[model samples]
Target: MSAALRIGMDIGGSKTAAVALDDAGTVVAATELGTVRGDDGVVDTAESAIVALATQTGVAPSGFASVGIGIPGQVDRGLGVVRNAYNIGVARLPLAQRLSARTGLAVSLDNDVTAAAIGAAHLMRLSGTVAYLNLGTGLSAGFVVDGVPLRGAHGVAGEIGHLAVDPRERPCPCGQRGCLETVASGSALRTYWPAGGDHPGRVLLSAIAAGDAEARAAYDALVAGAASCVRLLVLALDPHTVVIGGGLRLLGAPLVDGIRGELDLAAATSPFLTELELSARVQVLPADSSAAAVGAALAGNL
Candidate 1:
């Protein structure tokens, strides 16, 4: 008899991706679709994506053992509900239950970043305490302890992006001022850049490379805020590794190098900081991998 297949879907703000994995964890097929707004739309999109993947893999829906989903915003896995996903316009949705009803398979849901952390940990073969810092549309993090992403008491343990890091009191959609995300996220950087630029991050990086003073200052602040986030994670959890991922990670070496420079400067003045070895512990996720979807599939097995 053939091994049962597992389906994993990553419900992102702009796009939804799904992957079908055989029992051994090898991806058999994948599909992508643009996300639709509203609770019913999102659920329909997820169901469609899974059907597409199953078709691509030449397997019937009943061939899958389970379906796992990674969604942005607050999710109650136990209840299979998405409490609030502002980016995707879904609020208090019974995502898993709805998807399960549509696909006739068990469904599991988790925060997208947490699913990425689980995938990153598996990809890197990391054990013990690990941190996954995602600098995507908004900044957030996921903590994994002993190979399981720590969801915390309220399932918000790694929502560090909202922590206030700047004294300037910049407004945040989360109704906070000077949250780390307000200064360091991709969305925040676009707001900081000159209006009408086709690519704000690239523009800022190019100007910084050209030694523009204003661009340098702005970029410096972003790096400083990110380094502070790393410091906070290190101090709080002392994780064995801090893996950086998400949209901003596309900046590649320049982004990692900039963060390292900031931590190095701080370590020079504080022996405790030096002891943490923040620079050495930091790593970036590999390019061209759909980590969240993979992790969601793994979550199903778990």
Candidate 2:
């Protein structure tokens, strides 16, 4: 008999990544494509990913054991619905139902950050509890205990970005002023330095090197806000390890180093913070890690 394989897809604002995992959970096939926007476009993108993976694996779409999607949004996993994912232009989507109907496979949905947390733990071979902070276009977090994800009562356990922390009182989409996201995310970068254009992170470090004062200030805020997030995670969950993931992590070593520096500087002030070893616990998600996609595949098994 053909091995029962699982297919996983991580649908982001700009790209959709998919993978076919063998029974042993190894990714045997993988592909990435530009994500189309809107409700129909989102469904089509996912369907295309599944087809591509099936073709690569020589398995018919319906032959796969299941399909799991990790996407940014307010996800109702039980009903397989997604809402308020503005980046991908999906206001509301019956994602699982539509995809399952089309492919004749059991479909499951997960919050993208949660899926990344699961994938990060498995991929990095970490033990005990783990907290994944996604420094993407927006900030959010995910939690895992041992290998199980904590989705919380309303599935918004890690929406810490919306927490108001800054006295600057910058407006956030969530109708709050001075929210952490307004200070820390990709979107915040645009607001902090409009001259850098829409995708500023691409050129931010270079601009800072060129003595762009605005860029430097913005970068400082991002680093500080992210460090604050790490501190927040420690205070709340005290996870053994905190893995940083998302589009922004692509900034690479500088970003990680800056966050660690911030943590260390704060720890210098208080013995309570020093004993926590916050800097030591922080880790950057590998650039090549297919954590979210792989995590989606694993999530389906649950």
Candidate 3:
């Protein structure tokens, strides 16, 4: 009989993806599926998604050595439980425990962003300190040193979205006021949008391209959020390179240029700051967001 394969599943606020990586780290098979919507459709959706994946690829659950799920929520890695996942309506759910029960296979769970970071570090072929930044419906950062994740004591170390932006601003879902996500995320862009634009990124970018004054102002705010994270990222981790991914990265060159400008302003303060200016040096590849699933699958296996 052939050796069983390792399965990686990346679950985000929007969708879920799975990849089968063999012993060599090469993806042998992969698939993506939408997240369960509405209040009453989660459990079956989650179960069927995997069952479908198994059917699609002929990867029967019993044939796989184990399954890893990378989730975009607070995870109690210790207990393999998802403390809370508002979008998915999961609370204190024993993801790994339950999956293991359902499939009768070893299951591993990890923060989606953490999995992405590990994938990024590996992609860049970096062996030392590395940081992975994910800009999904939410933003998160995770550190991997010598191939291990620093899953902070509270399991929230990478929760940069909740990082405060302005104490006087709007209340965040996390119950805090003026969270960085409030001023910077795709959601924030939608909220702060000036009245006359189509989709948020296009509206913002069109104005930025036209040098529209209001657009430029809003752009500054958005970039500021990223820069603030960048500075914090540098001061704390000093990673050789910070891999930036997520939906926001789709903006491409314009995004890179804007961020480089902010890093420059942040630099005048310290040369070390300038040294980390990765606008041009950093490997900002088209983010293969599926990597998170791969990392998740391999998390405990490694």
Top of the candidates by lDDT: 2
Query: Model 3 over residues 1-302: C-alpha lDDT tens digits?
Result: 23467778887666778877777776777777787743334444556656766776686756777788888667877788886777776766777777777777787888888887777666566677777766555667888888887888887877878877665487787898888888667766766765424347656777667777766766677777776776677678777777677777776677767777787876778787666664543445464546687778778754
**Residue pairs with clashing backbones, model 3:** none
TM-score of 1: 0.93
Best to worst by TM-score, what's the order? 2, 1, 3
How large is the C-alpha RMSD of every model relative to the true structure?
1.9, 1.2, 2.9
Q: Tell how far residue 53 is off in model 3, in angstroms.
A: 3.5
Residue-wise C-alpha lDDT for candidate 2, range 1-302, written one tens digit per residue: 25588988899999999988888788899999999999999999999998898889888878999888999989999899999999899999999999999988999999999999988998898889999999888999999998899999998999999999889999998999999999889999998899889888889999999999999999999999999999999999999999999888888899999999999999999999999999999999999998999999999755
TM-score winner, 1 or 3: 1
Residue 137 lDDT, candidate 2, scale 0-100: 87
Q: Which one wins on TM-score?
A: 2
> What tens-digit string does per-residue lDDT give for candidate 1 at 1-302?
24378888889888998888776777788889999989888988987887787678777876678888999878888999997788889878998888888878899998899899988887788889989999887899998899777888988888898997689889998898999998887777777765416456657777877877776766777788888888989999999999889877877888899899999999999998998899998998987777899889888555
**In model 3, where is the ten-residue run with the lowest total lDDT?**
37-46
